[model samples]
Target chain A: TQLLEQSPQFLSIQEGENLTVYCNSSSVFSSLQWYRQEPGEGPVLLVTVVTGGEVKKLKRLTFQFGDARKDSSLHITAAQPGDTGLYLCAGAGSSYKLIFGSGTRLLVRP
Target chain B: SQTIHQWPATLVQPVGSPLSLECTVEGTSNPNLYWYRQAAGRGLQLLFYSVGIGQISSEVPQNLSASRPQDRQFILSSKKLLLSDSGFYLCASDPGGEKLFFGSGTQLSVL
Candidate 1:
């Protein structure tokens, strides 16, 4: 089975703090996606990184795909209370399937 | 614009009760459909996926089964429910571009 292991299962930070979440895997993926899910809601797509060594930014959130396509990272700059939620990294698989990571629950205090 | 809808919002049933969760997509045709389950504090588990009508692919072996009778409809059903089946179920549609659009999940509580 393909597994995406995420680091820092839980994170608690104050407003204006920056943090990075890592997702690593032994298998390579065609692309990687980052999603943020609030309580009681399904995950919403944040960004997708297709090319290896690619980097994309959305407002305060930055996503990077590893050169080997086996890992990815999400960096939040100056996180706010609105950023508090479960952050998930998913790798694209064949037949339109996605393999998701365990997730990182971020708590940004204001 | 395309939208995905999953119904019942929340359900509570006794073991051995039949299970039926429906998902439909609007404003799209021939879209890829998917069913996923998320345990509390866990990641999404791919249950089944369908590329077209009457086509379904199972990702894991369990009591659950899925079907796509129409171009834009996907159903997840079970003959018997176990305590392990209690979790948040999500339905998604592939809107091309390798991105998935998810609907509000259904929380199933098996008693």
Candidate 2:
């Protein structure tokens, strides 16, 4: 069974602070995706990194896929209260399955 | 617009009771469907997936069973429920970009 490890299972920071969440895996994935889930709601897609060493940005959020495609990270710049939620990293395999990371619960207090 | 719908926003059931949750996709056909379970304040876990009609695949073996009776309809069922089964259930559809569009989700409480 493949596993994805996320750093800092829980995080709390004040507004205007920057935070980064990491997802590392031993197995290589075809692509990696980042999602943010709020309480009582399902996860919503944030971004997807397909190529190794690829970097994608969404406004204040940045995503990177490792050169070996076995790891990824999400960095939030100048975080705000609205950015607080569970950040999840998911990897897709060749067999059409998505392996999800345990998730990082982030709280940005104003 | 493409959308996914899951029923029973919230449920309360006693242990040993039967379980049934439904998920359906609209405005899209022949897409991949998936079922996930989220423990209280945790990430999503892939439980089942369907690529086509009658083709259901399970990722983790547990007390749950999934079926795809139609192209856009998926159902999660269990003959018996356990307290451990209490969680938030989500349904998602893939539109070929490796991104899964998720439904609003269902919160089940097995007392």
Candidate 3:
């Protein structure tokens, strides 16, 4: 199994603060996807990084794929109250299955 | 545009009861389908997937089983339900690319 471990399982920060959530794995992945999930709802895809060392920006959110494709990161700058939710990173293995990280719950206080 | 639909947004059933959850995709053909279960405070666990009709692949060997009788429909069923089966069930599809489009999801509660 391609295990993706995300750090800081939970995070609480005041509005305008910056934070980074890390997803690491020992096995290389062909692609990695980041998602944000709200309570009582399915996850919504945020970004997909296919190439190594690729960085994509979605508004205030920045996502980076590791050079080795074994890790990824999600950074939120000047976070707002609307940013609170559960963030998950999924790595695609050789098969069709996606190995999901444990997830990180973040709360941005306004 | 394409859309995925999962039936019975919320279900409450007793233990040892039969279970059936249906998912269908519209405006697309021959897409990869996936069934995932999400426990509270955790990530998604892939239960089953299908590349085409009657081509189900079980990611985990357990009580739950999935079937794809048609090209655009996937069904998850079990003869007897377990308390551990209570969780959120999600269905997704990806025609191409690594990204998947998800359905609204089904919340099943086994008592």
Candidate 4:
């Protein structure tokens, strides 16, 4: 079974602070995706990285895929209260099934 | 672009009662559909997936069952509900490549 482990399961920071969340796995994936979920709602796709060592930016968020495709990271620059939500990383392997990480809950106090 | 629609935003049922959750997709045809269960503020556990009509794949063995009655419709059912079955159920669709589009989710409470 493939599993994705996320670091810093919970984070609380002041507005304007920078934070990074990490997702790691031993198995390689064909693609990785980042999602942000608000309470009582479904997760929204943030970005998808298909190539190794790839970096994509969306507004204040930067997503990076590891060189081996076994890990990914999300960095938030100057996070705001609006950025507080549960962040999840999902990896798609040969089976086309997405294996999701445990998720990191961010609380940005204004 | 694909959109997933799930019904009954919240459900409260007894342990021995039956269950049925419906999901439909729009803006795409013959899309890959999936059913996932999530704990409170946690990750997603894939329960079933269907690649085409009348095709279903189960990732785990439990009291739940899934079916695809139409090209864009997926249904999850159970003869009896369990306390462990209480969770947030989400319906998702894959528009070919692997990126998923998810529904608002249904919170099932089996009391």
* Most TM-score-accurate candidate: 4
In model 2 chain B, the worst 10-residue window by lDDT is B92-101
> What does the i-RMS of model 2 come to?
1.0
lDDT, ranked from best to worst: 4, 1, 3, 2
TM-score of chain B of each: 0.97, 0.96, 0.97, 0.98
Measured against the true structure, the TM-scores of the candidates, in listed sequence, are: 0.97, 0.97, 0.97, 0.98
Sorted into a CAPRI-style docking class, model 1 comes out as high
For candidate 4 chain A, the 10 contiguous residues with the lowest summed lDDT are A91-100
Candidate 1 error regions (>4 Å): none
The lDDT per prediction is: 0.93, 0.92, 0.93, 0.95
Give me the candidate number with maximum DockQ. 4
**DockQ in order:** 0.81, 0.78, 0.74, 0.83
User: Candidate 2, clashing residue pairs?
Assistant: none
Summed over model 4, clashes come to 0
The recovered share of true contacts, given per candidate in order, is 0.75, 0.72, 0.61, 0.69
lDDT of 2 by residue, B1-111 (tens): 689999988999999999999999998888899999998777789999999999999888899999999999999999999999999999999967568999999999999
